[model samples]
Target: MKIVEIGTGYTQIPAKIGAATEIVIENLLNGLNNNGIEHTLIDISYSNQVKNSDKFELSLTHYVNVPNWLNKIKDNGIIHIIRRIWYSIGVGLLLRKLYRNKLQTETYIHFHNQFNFFFAYLIAGRRLRKGKIRTIYTVHSPDWSNSKKIPKKLFFEKIAILKADVIISLTNIIKDRIKESVKINSCKIIVINNGVDLNKYHPIIQGDKQKQIINIGSVCKRKNQLETIVNIKEFLLKENYKFVFAGKIIDHKYFNEIVSYIHSQSLSEHVKYIGEVKPGSELNKLYNKSMLYISHSKQEALSLVVLECMAANTPVVLSENFETFVDFDSKIRNAVKIISNHNLINEINNLCNNVSYHKQYALKQMEVIQEFYTWDNIAKLMIKKLAQFKQTL
Candidate 1:
């Protein structure tokens, strides 16, 4: 079987260069390759240059001529270029042209983002109805939270859920959200959590790690990083642990506010901002050299970074009210310290004080990740589902 994976928004295919969706798509392609499955990736990049390599075939669409304002809107997810009339018409025509030469069941198109899902619906929905080709969509987060309260977004999400041949949910929570938004049988939805590369993100030497706490993600309000800092202010004042914040500062105002708070609290020395670090060895090193990984985000759907930390045998602290952990295995859920803003300090202190407990949880998290969250295992599950899908056809 051949698979064509369409990336969302940009052209950085199969890497950590984009969002979590892009990283997940890359890992999925690697897993498929390991299993001897042939696949292709299509994406748009910031540059007009395009090339194909032996690793995988790539088709890029560069938007250099477009106005900066339009690019900004597309980049921020306010408006997707794929959904625009001109792009949609071109994509529709291309799909129709491809349909003339390929068997419907021989090829499968997978969309990693909702915009692309809607694009597929517009371009190939009719052909899908006629069995000209199959399509699958991975819903990163059936974003039902207040942070993603865009009516238009919700509408497109419902449409994608209803229209896709099969939908993959990163967690049961996301699946539940999809069900909440629209009526769909459970059979159409498959719960497949994002996976980590244990080989790449394994534990480091004990002496190499420092008494540091790390948070990797965009420095923004939705991440709630500033609130987390406030919640643990007293703890930071007392303990020797340093708080390290990484990732791009998408919201400049929020970033400034966080900086101001840090300055006001006299935490300039204790809090370190490394800006954005490209994923790979450097990121793995950051994960490995941390005593604790914290994600104080207001919402999430199975964070790949958290899994990477667990794979590296680093225990994580998350918001007590975090809804995504409901899909984690019991052992993993127990290993992660869930504390709300009210008790963040005490909870972290408890873990920090009990060195044995910290080590125990770290080891348990690593074991759980090895058994349940590796990309190899995730790929097998996905392939099994795809095989079943083929049988039904």
Candidate 2:
């Protein structure tokens, strides 16, 4: 059987698909090539075309065309307003018409996030009737729904998801959220937790201690990275531990606030804002050097960074927000000390002292992940289910 997977590209040296998402498919390919399962994966391209894949039989690097008049190209925001008005009406028709002539084949739909899935559905939903293809969506995060300038676009996201033959949720928590929000047969939604490669995220054997803990993703409001820095200052007192926030600072006002907070607290030296990581080996080196990976997002589906932290054997300290954390394994939870915005110093003190505890937890969870979360295991399950689709149909 041939499997076709489409995702944002990472085949290049500096893959934009984030570490965990890239690793998931890598592990999947590892299993597939080992088992001799033939497949193809197409990376979404920037130049409005599809590129060929060496590993997969057929691949397309097609891009969603930017309407000649992209609505949100803001110099003063009128275009954004116009785009918002047009997005609701034009997306469905435009997509449907664009792919009208081509694309009649059996394939699996892979969703990197909710945006593309919605767009695919709006444009391609009508095409499903003509072919024998099965589509699935993998949730990367809770509709990260870019800049506030872009309309939430939540309504279309749900509608496109419903059109799918199957919905592949990264976690049980994610599946339940979709169920709670959208009415559909429970059987249509499958829980395929995100996977990690043991070899890649393995612990560093070198006996060295580093005072800096890295928190990835852009330094935006949702990430709540400031909480970690603020708390570290309060908890560590001497201000020894450093924070490496490695991502773009999209919001200027938010950036100012973070800068002000650091200055007001006189903790500028302790916080280092390394711009966007330039992909490849440099990122792996950054992960290796950091002792802990921390995230304090107010909301999340399941995070790629958390999995990367696990892969790097860097224990994580994440927010105990209600939306995302409920479904993690008890052991994974125990290993991580979730904070609901608490006394920063004590939390830091506890985590800093408990390196052995986290290392053991990381190792244990790695074994469980290897058995179930690998992309190969997930693809095998999908193939089996694809075969059985007719019975259910």
Among these predicted structures, which one has the highest TM-score? 1
TM-score per candidate, in order? 0.86, 0.76
Query: What 10-residue stretch in candidate 2 is worst by lDDT?
Result: 143-152
Q: Could you give candidate 2's per-residue lDDT for residues 43-147 as a string of tens digits? A: 433233333344343233233333443522443346544433344233344445544664544555455435445655555676644555566666565543221
Tally clashes: model 1: 1
Q: Itemize residue pairs with steric clashes in candidate 1.
A: 11-44
RMSD of each: 3.7, 5.6
TM-score of 1: 0.86
Q: For all candidates, what are the clash counts?
A: 1, 7
